[model samples]
Target: MTQHTPHLWSRLRYRFDILMAHGTPVLIGWLTAVCLAIVVPASVVLVGASRDVPTTAAGWGAAVWRSVGQTLRLGGEVGSPVYVMMSVLLALVALLFVSALVSLITTGLHHRLLALRSGRSPVLEERHTVLLGWTDQVFPVITELVAANADRRRATVAVFADRDKVGMETEITSRVGGTGATRVVCRSGSTTDPTLLSVVSPHTAKAVLVLPPEDPGGDAHVVKTLLALRATGPETRDCVVVAAVRDARNHPAAALAAGPHGHVLSVDDVVARLLVQTSRQPGLSLVHQELLDFAGDEFYVVPVPALTGRTFGEALGAFATSSVVGLRRDGGGMVLNPPSDTRVGPADRFVVITEDDGTAVLADTPPAVDEDAIVTARPRTQAAERLLLLGWNRRAPLIVEQLASYVPSGSTLDVVTLADAAAVRGACRPGRLDVRFLRGDTTDRGRLAELDVPSYDRVLVIGDRGHAVGPDAEPERAADDRTLVTLLHLRDIEQSAGRELFVITEMTDDRNRLLAPVREGADFIVSDRLVSLLMTQISENRHLAALYDELFAAEGSEVHLKPAADYVVTDRPVSFATVVESARRRHECAIGYRLHAGAATGPAHGVRINPDKREPVRFGDRDTVIVIAED
Candidate 1:
C-alpha cells in the first residue's frame, strides 16, 4: 500500500546504463573513470582497516598507500603477513576489474568491426553504377557493364543487397573471373531501406540497376526498391533507374514509383516474345545476342553529318564497317529497320551495329554494287508447319499468343507438359493454331519419342519453372537442369533418326547455357541472360528500347537467316557488297551471312553481322544470308 523511493546506488546504476546505451566515447570514458574511482579506493580502505592494522591515522594512511602501490604493481613483500595478505587481496580485485573493462572494450570493438564489414559505412563515389538487389542476373549485368566501360581508365559498380558483403564479392569474383578496369563494390543492406540505400551513394551514381530478387514475390520487391530509389531525393531523380519486374501486373505500379527516369523491363513478357520470335526463326537468337552483348558488335547511336539528306536506304550502304539498322529522330524516338524512303533529317542520328563507337564512321565512298549478281526475288510465302512445344511455364501462354500471330492459319502446335492439358489448351487460340495438348514429362525419352520428334518441323523446349519451386531447389538452376535434360533427349532422338531437326531450347541461367550439349541443329535462348542483356543495353541507350520492341513484335521487319541460293549463286566467289545489292533489290537489308556448316559451333556459330563489304567470300549452297525483312 506504500511506495518507497529508489536507492541512491540504484539511481546511479540506472543513469550509468543510460550512458552506456548512448554508446558515445565520452560517456564510456566517464563510466570507466567512475568504476576505477569506486573500486580502487574501496580496495585500499578495506586493506588498511584489516584486523592487525596500526592505530594512528598517519600509520594507517602510510599502510593504505603501500597497499595501493603493491596492488598497482600486483606484487608485495612476503615477510609481513598483513601486508602480504592485503597485497594478494588487492591484486585479485584489481585483476578482476581490469579483465571486466578489457572484455567490455573488446566486445564493443568487435561489434563496430562487424558493422563496418556488413556495409554500414557510407560509400564515397561519383559517376558510379549502383546495383540494387541480387539475383542470378547480377553476374551477367556486371560482366556487360565491365565490357561497356572497357575503354574507360577506371569505373565503379556498387552493389547493395540484403546479403553478406564478403559472400557477394566472393561469388561475383568466382563467377565473373575479372571485371577488367571496373571495380565492383558490394554492400550488405536491404533494397527497400532508404538509409541503407544511401550507402551506395545513389545521388552521385550515373545509373542504377534494380535487379528483381530470386523469390516468389520478386515483382513486389522490385516495386519497393524502385519506390526507395525514387525517394532518394531530387539529385537522383534524373539518374537512370533500370529495373526488371517478373510480373506484368506490377509494371504500372513499378513505373509510377520509378517516375520519369525509370525504365521497367517485364521479364516474362520479354522472354515470351523472344521465345515466340526465335521459335519460328532458328538462328535469330544469335543475332540478338551479338547485338545485345558487348563482346561482339553492338548497337551504337552516332551522328553523321553526311547522312542528313540521305534516305535510310541510302545511308545503309554508307557504312562499310558498320551496319545501319535504324535511325534516332532529332526530337525523340527510334525507328529500327525503318522504311527505305524515310529521309534522314539534319538532326537525325544513325543507329548502327559496330564493334565500337568509332567503328560506326561512314565511308567516303560506298562499296560498288555488283549489278550482275543482283537477283530480285519475291518474299517467301507462308506455309502450314508442325511445331512441338516441350514443357510449360508462366510464359507459355504469352508465347502461344505471340506464336499464333506469326504462324499460318493451318499451322498445328502440339504442347507436351506434366501440367494440366486443359490449362495449357486454355492459353492457346484454337482459331489461329490447331492446338493439341499431351500430358507427359518432357524430359522423359519415351514421351519425347511418342511425340515423333523428327516429324515436327521445329521443336521448342520450355524450361520447367515449377521444378525450381520445389524444396531444396534453386529456381534458375533447377529450371536449367530440366531444360538441359529435355534438350539432351531431343538431340538423341535426332541422332538416332539420322535426321536434322530444328530445336530451340530455353535456359533460365546463362551459366547453364554453357553446360548445354553442343548439337548441330539446336539453338539456346537463355531467358534471364537475354533479359539482362536487353536491360543493360536499354540502360546504356534508352533509345534502343524502341528498336528492341519493334524487333520482338509480331509485325515489322525482323532478322532472318535465308538460304544463300535465294540471293546468290552458291560456290561462286563474290563480295558481300553483291549480297547487299541483291537483298536491296528485294527491298530487304542484308546485314551479314550465316554459314550452314558452322551454324552449330560456339562463338559466332555461322552468323556474321556487319562484315566488310569489300572482302571476297564464297558461300556454299547450304549457307544462309542474314537479312532484315518483313514476312
Candidate 2:
C-alpha cells in the first residue's frame, strides 16, 4: 500500500547478502534439528527391545518420561550428566550452523572486496579507459597492449563487458595465451554502468578499446558506452577512449559521444578505403600485415637527428638499420615515395619501419652486381591486364576499377559474381570493368577451376556481402581459408593450363598469410593489421597513407625479397656500409631482411628473418634479399 524509500532497497540488498552468507549454517542447523527429532526419541524408547512384555500405560509413561533424569547419568559418562549431553548435541548443531553461516558470509565478502580492490569498482577509480562493449576486438586490443608494453615485464588490462564474469575470464584465457606476464582481468557489467566503470579503474587506464558486438544490440551498447565514458568529469576524465561503430550511419553519433573523450573509428569507412587500395594494388594486404604487426617490421616515427638539412634520399640512407621511407612534421603531410629532393627538417619525423624493437639501422648492404649488370632502365612490363574477379563485395568492384586505373587500360576485367550480372552490368562504369556475373560460390574448387582463374594476372577473393572481412578480421585467416581453397583449386587449374599465377587475396587478418599452403603462391590482403598500422600511422601524421600508397604501388613501388648475393660484390661477411652505398647506388631503400641460412631449394630456404639481427649479413648463392626497387 505504501512506496518504499530508496534506502529500503539498499538495506534489503545488504540484508539479503547477510542471509545468503549464512546459508551453510542454516543447512547445518536444519540438519541437526532433524537428527535430534529422530534420534532423541528413538534412544528414549529402549523398552522396544522387549515388545512382547505386557506393560501398563502408567509404567510405560514413567519409563519413557518420569525417569528421564536417569539419562543425565549417561551424559555424566562424558561430562556433567544432563547438562553435558544436552550441551554436546546443542554445541555440535550450533557449531555447524555458525560455521556454515560464517563461510557463506565470508565468501561473499571476499568477492565484493576483490571486485572493489580491482579497478572494476567505479566508486574508487574514474577516468580510466572504459571499454564499452566487448567482442573479437578485445583480443587484438589485448594483444597490442602486450606488444606495446614489450619493454615492460608486466601490464594490466581491465575488461568490462555484458558477458558473464566467468565467461569473460574464460574467453579471454582461451583466446589470449594463458602464459603471459601481463594480466587481463574482466568484470561482469554493462558499459553504461558508471558504477562498474569504476571497477575497471577507467580514470587511469591508458586507453580504452570499445568494440561493438556483432549484431545490432551491440551497436546500441557501444553508443551508450561512448557517451557515458565521455561524460566523466574533467579531473577523472581525459583518458584515451577508442571505439568502433558497426554501421557507417552510427559514426556521427559515436563520434559525438566520443567527443574530446577520445577517438572513434568507423570500420565501414576504413574497410571501404582498404578495399579500394587492395583492389588497385595486389599484395598490399601483405604490406598491411608488415605494417600492422607490432612484432614485425612496421611504420614508426623516428627522429632523424642526422638529417636536419638533408633530403629524404640522403636521410633514408643515413640510418644503418632503419630506413627513412617518408617524412612527418608540423605541417607537411605524408609524402610516400617522395621525390628525391624532399628535405628533412628538425620537426619532421621520419616514418621508418622496423621489427621487434626500435629501428636498428643496419649498415648498407653491398652491391650484388657491378654497374654493368645493374639495369638502370625501368623493368617495364606489357601494358594493362585482363583481370577476372572470382567474387564480389564492397571491395571487389573497387579492386577491379583500381587495377584498371593503376594498370594500363588495355587491361580488361570480367567479374564472376553470384550477384545479378544484369544489375552489375547496369551499375558498371563504362570501360572500367566488363561485368559478367556468374551465380556461384568461389569456394567450389571444381566449379572454380572451370573458370579461367589463372589467365588473369590478378584474382581477388571478396567475401559475400555483409560477410566481408574488414578491420575486425585482421590476419584475414578465415578469408584466407576460403581464398586458399579457391587458390589451391586455381593453382591446379593453372598447372593444368601450364601457367604460373600471380594471385592477390583481400583477407582481413595478417595471420592468414602463413595459412596459404600454395608455395610462393598468392599475395594476400591482411587488411585488419594493415588498417591498424595505417590508422596508427595516420594518427601520428596524415601523410603516411600517401607515402604508403607509393611504396605499395605496383608500378611505382615494390617490395622484393632479394638474395644477399644480389648485393655482394664478393662472397664475404659484408658490412651494411657496403650495402648502403650499393643500395643508394641502385636508388633503392634496403630495410630489414630475411636470411636463408640453410637449404638448397626454393626462396630463401630455411630463411631466418628476425633473429640475431644485430649481426652483419653474409650471403651465399642460395640466399636472396628483399629489396624495394622501382619498376
lDDT tens digits by residue: candidate 2, 1-631: 9996678889999977876688897866876687657655864566455564327874554454422334422221233457656855775676678889999999999999876544355423432233456655566666765665567676666778767766777777787776366666667776787655655766676566677575545557778887666555442333566666655667788878776545666655555455545554433444455556555556666665656887866665555446555567657566544556777777887777666335545346422323432223235455666666766554454455445555555667766655666656654566644445566777787677677676666665654442332222322344456766766677677778887666656555456656665545244555444444444443333344456556544447555555555565435666544554455566666554544344324333343332232345666665554455674
Best by lDDT: 1
lDDT of 2: 0.57
TM per prediction: 0.81, 0.68
**TM-score of model 1 relative to the true fold?**
0.81
Q: How many clashes in each structure?
A: 0, 56
lDDT of 1 by residue, 18-77 (tens): 877877887858966876687579766776678877788766665665665564565644
Candidate 2 ranges with C-alpha deviation above 4 Å: 1-104, 110-132, 192-199, 216-224, 233-241, 244-287, 304-307, 331-343, 356-375, 379-381, 431-450, 466-485, 507-517, 526-588, 592-631
> Considering every candidate listed, which one attains the maximal TM-score?
1
